[model samples]
Target chain A: MLSIPARRTNDVTPSEITPREVFERRRDFLGTAAGFALGTALAPLSAALASEKPLASIKSPLSTPEKPTPLKDVTSYNNFYEFGTDKADPALHAHTLKTRPWTVSIEGLVKQPKTFAIDDIFRLGALEERIYRLRCVEGWSMVIPWLGLPLATLLKSVEPLGSAKYVEFISAADPKTMPGVNRSVIDWPYLEGLRLDEAMHPLTLLALGLYGEVLPKQNGAPLRLVVPWKYGFKSGKSIVKIRLVEKQPQTAWMKANPREYGFYSNVNPEVDHPRWSQASERRIGEFLKRKTLPFNGYADQVAPLYAGMDLKINF
Target chain B: MAWWFALSQGKRHVGLFKIALFAVCLIPLLRLVWGAWNDTLGANPIEFITRSLGSWALNFLLITLCVTPLRKLTGWNWLLQLRRMLGLYVFFYASLHLSTYLWLDKFFDWQEIVKDIFKRPFITIGMSAFAMLLPLALTSTKGMVRRLGGLHWQRLHRLIYVIAICAVVHYWWLVKLDVSLPAIYSVLLCILLGFRLLWPGQGRRNVISGNFKPAQE
Candidate 1:
């Protein structure tokens, strides 16, 4: 065409001639087609792949690049007693939980008590990614990247009364669905609670997802509490009810064995558990036990919250 | 009656049974080694190995306890021949369990281990039980039995009953909430100890000697 500029040997390639818009449009088409193909290919396993989503972008100074616990370990090694007593039992049994259409009732000592769908809870605030160290009462630890809003944001929306000293979390208890609930390993409708101030702390998270995906069933799908400074058990999973109360709530483990599990359940290295020493903890991916940190190494941020309180007595 | 006499003679097939039992006793350890080699000890290998060894030790203790009652009830007095071997396996497993705690779990941190032994009730009881088991395991040889004399050996071996109790208590105290397994062991122990109370002469007569004879036969 028009002598083709004398067919110069140094001319631009065909890709260079292509318009940027056209290339972008082609990429978009290909992406959609691949997604559709993948969707069809993974149809049978949709339930297993139900919660796979793009990672959230919200950042914090606390977030670490130290590779989070493998998704396999995070999902499999859990202590959700509603499923069973064994650590492996929750992963084995919790998949039966239906997370969609989940609702959490925020009642008691609130000016406006409401039962909000999980989606609505998400809409309440922008979800942020927070990587935190979860130390279990059994002297095991895991680094979890949780995606959620701060608990204070949610509590503030509900408008708590002056009398609300404690916030009690009630987990779901459908025995027909949760096989472990049929057994009396723990009291039904597993209950956990925190002091109102602790509940409202910026570190306290109402977690909706983990590892850049929506929460897996075993890791407490749809909704759970993530208290970075406390023992993992204190962070109740699959929470259905949040009741702001005047009196201290009788937590499940404490009710089960008061001497062994206390109400506060803070991560204190000096305070040995009744049956075993808590001076050291085994991080899940590591071999040698590492010395346990006071307040799980959140002593700088959260220690001031418990300024005068004796951790051993409160623990 | 001739077949029964032949079976209880404690000579024929004794070596074969002893070899088989020896292999069987090593199965747990072999399986644990294989598991460690293959990286199949799950998320917490130390906990898994410790628990497996501890349970095996308790099982052996119960098995050793069962020997007297079984020998008396079945009149297969030759079962006495296996008691020393079974008791020795108990010591083997218990020693391995303790070593896992001391060497592996504590990493030779003697100060912390000692603190744990003193502060933790379960560890304290467990260490006490291991201490009680030491002399019995050492005296398991035929030479030791001959040197100590049968009466003294029997008196020393009576410590097994207390060791059994201590082992069960150690297990019972270690569990967080599910005591079902320990409860089952306790009931079995009760039946074994109760049977001795009901029928007293079984333990006294069944104590084996180096030059053995079937007491009932």
Candidate 2:
């Protein structure tokens, strides 16, 4: 018989090998290949397996055809200023956030304003997987598989008044846990807003998790707002309060620079930011900058919201 | 140790010191290469590489500016020998930075590139700063120095001060907030320029430029 090398005592089991579905995810297999340390923490490997409290969600009919951005990029790279402005800051620092004792309140121009526990929010509607195109104001984009109930479903439960023209989303700001809150980068709590109709749009999502697990803290744990038609920042993370109001609310970015950020911060290839061109955005994990689509390729579905208005002025 | 500091007879040390500084300067590029080879360039590899190269380019520019002040203070005339090479490294890193944006980021989307150059103020200023560096880099050769008169060459190289200032402003405007890093670079650039005004010697060597003792610009 030919000499056969035995399986090494330190070798990984077949089950432990990373799934081949995503190319970047194969780094785990290389960690055992000898020479280089890939710098990925072992803790995240189990996290990616999504064995811990995996919530059930059905695939949504509205999902795009694009392959989801790698989970590592979706988790490791974030724009949550509550943690910090740097892309990696949130992933490094968001462990300090306490998502267990969270409660979100719905009030203002609603007949039945109520504060609900985190669990109660989940009971509001059936969860679904919405693969969305997230275009950031800084000329970057990502396709994320979000697990959440629709914002309209949640808004309907609260019962809004006819006079409620806008819905403001207020993110939780804990200075003791969140380090970025200590900096004067912007006003304390991140405030995001949408028109009442936009809030009730079927495309809008009140996301609670992503990649099939309760959301990673960096990607906005507990709960977050997802408006697929707008810039990524318009989707407020770690929302604590939702208030319905008659007048347009001033969001965090608008307060910081009203000239650059407006109330309706929708994605538009024609409208460029003052500092850089938004005509093209480099997608996460991709080398080439792709041309940005009007309303992030959801113009067919959501463009009706801004029917006659000039997008440049609203941008 | 005593043999190392023989300032009057430092010709033997010049070659070795240049080699040492050149290797030291290449460390940033080496790290970037290692990172790219290992697939450890993080979530957005292109952006990370682009920013890393840009930051190093700025750092090299600042380091090139430091050569004259250090030479004047320490009487390390040998330091001047490394100035041209240090300046050329800035162009090297800058060229890499622009290449990353062009090849990897834009993928030769010349339409978007041209529009960005015209529309974006930061890109406009950054492109201008890089443009100013071309003549200085092209004229760095000993042959070119002799071709242009010493006075004319010195005057042309004064554009470095303006280039450095434009670079720092480009950095300052590119950031959405946290002007702290750019603020530090600005202070350093001011001090570098202010030294010329204060001592009034380490500038374009003209008899009328300063009353102080002779020092090359």
Candidate 3:
């Protein structure tokens, strides 16, 4: 049984997991004991901190040639507002988050609504190594080699209704676990959305891990969306509720400041942020700022989806 | 003669205290240098260095501004001797902050730097504050005070008030969300600057006119 008390009594707990938690803890103890017997005190302690087991994945054709940002740098310099606004806050505070016994409820305008266990989500398809160029609205970029399958795999399982136009992702914002939720920094539960077609794009990833390992707690452990064609925030983190809707879903950033953020936050250097220029972005490891590419260098694959739409107005 | 000269006369430990103060002021820079050498300045080292220098400048500015009040409350008239050094340190840190921006952040891309200065209000305000601090720093010496005259030098240094306001606003505007840290700075600055408004004759004669007489609490 999960000792980390559930937020809601009605939350579905699969019977098999009751023993799994205890087994996991016992295995962890055994692993630590074995590690100590080997006379490597640091091996277990370091592993205990967050070993984030290496996930099973194959080389992906979609992966970019650019060098991936250093794992420590990638994990530490995150902008997940759920934990806090500062880049380093998530790395420090996210350890309190409980990733196991998690379920993502898929409902609304779907023919076969389903509640997916974390295991079920992983079992969808063979995972791939997607090295993506992630451009943030704040003018910083990172090339991340992520481990995951297409988000469309999960979406196809639920089979959306004809009326569905957009897919909304809602992040878990437990005030008890996430201290940042106590503050009135934007609406509590972080929300992000994508056009139904955009959500189904081949480049759009249902990211499970990074650096060939299960994601660090700070990098939205358990699950997160990675929309390479859009601004980094367009990819929601620790997504709990996924909904297919008739109208374009209102995003957290959009609600916070509609004028600055919009429904379509595609990467276009020409359409600058109201406060700052988007022409150039400082790559994480490198000193020189690189010119931001259209659709973050995925324009060939994604631009066709928005051929006629004016990005300037939609942005 | 200034009231400080009479009261501060023959202060036995002031020299040693100044040497200690100078060393204490270098600690922030020392820590940054050590961090750089050790590769522990977080992921974004340049940003960390730039922000650290800016924060130190703001802290030194506030400390410099607080000297008068500290002297009044504690009757440590010798504290006045350290105020000039403290004010100069604000410029030292501010100069490093600007240099980091130009060198590490921008790579001396003057065109882009100019664009940032004009396009970003926060940058504009920050640059203006640094620009104002330059004249005060240059005229800090006794010779410059004599050449410019006491009244003129005092007027020139009064720009610290404006410079401090700009520094706070520059910080407050740049943060994307959670202004609580900057809000704390703003409140402390308000209390420090508020003394002038709340004091007798609005602290003009004793402060603005260089009236160094000890204020009766």
Which one is best on TM-score? Answer: 2
TM-score of each: 0.85, 0.86, 0.86
Give one digit per residue, the lDDT tens place, for model 2 in B1-217: 6754665466557787778889999999888777766667677767788898999999999999988888788777777888888999999999888887777766787997898799888889999999999999999888787787666777788899999999999999899866788999999999988888887544645634533231232
Write model 1 residue lDDT over A168-218, tens digit each, in one string.
999999988888898887888899999999999889999988876688899
Clashing pairs for model 2 are B203-B217
Q: What is the interface RMSD of each candidate, in Å?
A: 24.1, 12.6, 15.7
Give the per-residue lDDT of model 1 (tens digit) for B93-210: 9999998888768989999888888988888889999999999989888788778877777788889889889899999999988788899999999998998888965545555443
Cand 2, B chain, TM:
0.90
lDDT of 2 by residue, A19-77 (tens): 46533533443334212212322234334324656665555667785767777778988
Name the weakest run of 10 consecutive residues (lDDT summed) in model 2 chain A: A1-10
lDDT of 2 at B42: 74
Over the stretch B73-169, how does candidate 3's per-residue lDDT look in tens digits? 7677778788889999999999999998887677799998999899889899999999999999999887787788766777788899999999999
Cα-lDDT of candidate 3: 0.82
Which segments of candidate 3 are over 4 A away from where they belong?
A: A1-53, B1-10, B206-217
lDDT of each: 0.81, 0.82, 0.82
Candidate that would win on lDDT:
3
Error of model 2, residue B20, in angstroms: 1.3
